[model samples]
Target: MRILNLLKIAFKAIVLNKMRTLLTMLGIIIGVASVIAMLAIGEGSKASIRETISAMGSNMVTVRPGADDRGPARGSGGDVQTLIYKDYEKIKEEVSLINYITPVVNGGGQVINGSNNWPSTIYGVNPDYLNIKVVGLQSGSMFTDAEVQSASKVVLLGQTVVDNVFPDEEPVGKMIRFNNIPFKVIGVLEEKGENTFGQDQDDVVIAPYTTVQKRILAIDYLNQIMASAVSEDDASEVVEQVTEILRSQHKLLDSEDDDFTVRSMEELISTFSSTSEMLTILLVAVASISLLIGGIGIMNIMYVSVKERTKEIGLRMAVGGKGSDILMQFLIEAILISITGGLLGVLLGLTATVFIENFLHWPTSVALYSIIVSFAVCAITGIFFGWYPAKKAAALDPITALRYE
Candidate 1:
């Protein structure tokens, strides 16, 4: 039989029962649409998180105090401070992987300017801190390396601090008091928005490590250290080198554990990337269940169609159409229904993704692979679900169908 003739017969049958055909296709439409939308949302969230993490400087590494392994054999308090300026010095001198190193101590207080004060956080670090973090100065200048080493009580304000404290005045060389000790402001940092951890980078102040250590904290030890590797590929090696240096400098043998943790940007990015990708796959997997249900619905309707048209099938078979022809006609009809529904679902899913992305202000990206996968799934479901009905119709006894009431 001619495919067009068979397709015409199929079309006539569907047109005869338009409402049934529409209802049968509803499941496929919903399933395809959900899968596309869910995948788009997942990809968008993953991209957003990655951007947030990158904004903190992709080549950076952070060193923080970890559980002390060598101190007093577990319960003893001999751990003391794990991080100190001497460790920073050794890492800079001995580790070739480290490009820049800086010690940091943080405290929060209300910043006052002519009776207009804003509560903010502060970081005390060396002049190399800006270079290591790739932080740019928006106006004025950063505290010179000379000033940092001299403990010259100089400070740099962030953009947010500038907006609040000296909105109408030039803050260069102006005095801002921290812990009631006045320090001259030498520069302002460029604006950096919120990080993945939800920290406002532009809401804090930066002061020389010497001044912050001796004056504010009044301690010789550092709370944390920030360093940057030459490149992302070298980050792990840099971490290993820094760990060994700190361990050796602190006089911990191989028998004793280290008291510090070193984390690389590549490690963090990979962790977040894997987590995001898995979540996306999981969401898509869950949405695929809807597709399965829809496919089953299609199969159910196809079965009903074959039973209700049994006599018609026998008439066609007796007239000259072979059983194979009958099967092909029915299978093609199912494919047409599914393809139509699948295309519509793709359009609807794209529209919904656009609305969601624009309304919620999240990143949404639709990969071409998703569309191809969706359509392929639709076709597979149609063929798999249509098989039973096609086979049943092909097996119909012409005499029995002809005598049907």
Candidate 2:
């Protein structure tokens, strides 16, 4: 009966001061909403990066020329010429876990079709390149092993090249020049669009590495070796086997460090995930400041509320109201304000996230934990901030309080 009366009194007090209560809760509302929005953006970005890397072939591994030791004796990794065609052949013959392998060489040049030309990257790879990359042809077929052996000047155009260089005409079965070196178009690749790094995946041309090495770059060494494991689970095993084979093929002693760098898609994914997580943590930390400010707002408002109700407290005390009852009454008022504000904040946060994702095209993924945690924090804030003011009201001398103007 006593608790119900205290609750009624608390409810009555809040109803009498609607505007003041709302203004007091504004801090908590903004704080909770900000925290939720920040968390959604963070989680969404992490997922987006993982998905982009996975689409590039989760079972793939890349071997690049370079010593990772960063020693003064070793030049930059991309500039190293340690990876050769023989190293690729040795791995192909020795490693059983990989399902597809290709020796890759790349150069940047303008691809010309009549008067139309676009600056694009040309990737020299064998027939297995498409298989390793997990991409398929939209028209025509990939170059055959015979073409690779003959160093035939045949090319496959990505969607961007087709759009720019052959907008009104079919790209397949046509002649195009790369750096003034004429080539026959064998195929057109499907549209892959931009990746997570914002690089255009479609702005490329692929041909046999032999053609690029002998005729274009005049280089005898391979730029890189790309392979795909039979299964994503086998990627690590494939990496290990390729490393051992390359080391043996190079005739390096056991004590010598590797002259090449090998990395699997799984490793790449893990690295990206870790970095994204750190960024998420940072964003969430910055958003948490709003919650602290909201708590402080609650405390200040409760203090003012106690001061304004001093006469009411004194009259109640004279009318046989217990100090504990007065304390509970004010504390209940604070809690009601906090909880109501929390509910509004949640709705605002969800709406803001949707707006950001749909209108602004920003990534957002609201975690259930974030909402629950924010609400829990709100309740705790109410109790913590409301305590001292309630205590002060309870300790006031009834006679003295009644005499105050």
Candidate 3:
């Protein structure tokens, strides 16, 4: 009965100072909302990156030509012609950790179907390229190893390519001209969406590496080499082995630097995870400041509340209320205010997240942990900030408080 009466009085007091209560809660509202929003955005981005990387094969490593220090001081020299098919074949034969190896030479130009033309990147790779890239055919069949060896003018269309050139017709067995050269479309790749780097997965056309090297670009070297390890755990080992092999093939002495850079999916994932965790921490830290401000606001209003209600407290004390009761009442009022603000902030945060996701077309994933953390933070803020004022109110001398105006 006593607790209920005290809670009733606290509720009435808050009701009487509606404007002040709302203003005090404003900081908490913004803090909780921003924390939730930032966390959701960060989680979504991390998930998207992981998905894209996983799609490219979990145990894969890419080797791109780095500037040869022997030829270039920084970025001026070191010609683009570095890696060759021989290096790819050597890596395949020499590295036991390697499960698949493929060389890629890419060219970009207009792909034409009669009067219709679309700009797309054309990749030339072998049958092993599909395995290394983890690409799957949605329609028709991938070019066989024989076609790749024969340098056949056969191509595979990505989904976006299909939409652009053969919207209404089946692309398989259809011919598309690239740079006036006719190449038959043998297959279409399933849509893998965009990569984390914002490159469209569907806007690519793939052909035999030999064809792109000899017939189209007349290039004798590769743009990049992709290799998949026998197992994900062995990816680092495989990268080291491939790097050694490339270094040897390029005739780089031990004293010389590597002319290529080897990157593994594992390393990239770790870097992304570390970077994301840092960003999440930074965002939460900034949001916590708002919570602190809100706490201070609560403390200020609570002090004012205790002052304004001094006469009431004196009357209650004189009528038989103890110091602990006065302390409990004020503490309860502070907790109620915080909890109310927390509930409202949670709703506002979730609603704002939904709005941003829909309006901006960016993915957002709200985690249950975020809600739990926010509530805990709010509760703790209440106790910590409300302690001083509640203690002050409890220690008041009833006789002196009665004399207070």
Name the candidate that leads on lDDT. Answer: 2
Error of 3 at 235 (Å): 7.0
| Residue range 56-131, candidate 1, lDDT tens digits | 8777888877654545655322134678888888888888877888888877787777776788877888877887
Please give the TM-score that candidate 1 achieves against the real structure. 0.74
- What candidate 1 gets wrong by more than 4 Å, as runs, is 1-16, 46-59, 65-86, 89-101, 105-137, 141-154, 172-186, 192-200, 207-222, 228-241, 264-286, 358-369, 398-405
**Model 3 lDDT per residue over 44-82, tens place:** 777776776789787888887874454545552124567
Query: Backbone collision count in every prediction?
Result: 0, 0, 0
Per-residue alpha-carbon lDDT of candidate 2 for residues 1-405, written as tens digits (9 for 90 to 100):
988888899999989999998988888898888889888988898878877887798899999988777667877554788999999989998889888999999988999999999999899999998888878999999999999999999999999999999999998999999999999999999888887678889999999999998888888998999999998889999989988888888888988888898999998888898998998888878777887788789889999988988998999999988889888988998888888888888888899899999999977899999999998999889888999899899999999888767
Sort all candidates by lDDT, best to worst.
2, 3, 1
Taking all chains together, each candidate's TM-score versus the true structure is 0.74, 0.69, 0.71
Say which candidate scores most in TM-score: 1
Span of 10 residues, lowest total lDDT, candidate 2: 70-79
Clashes of 1: 0
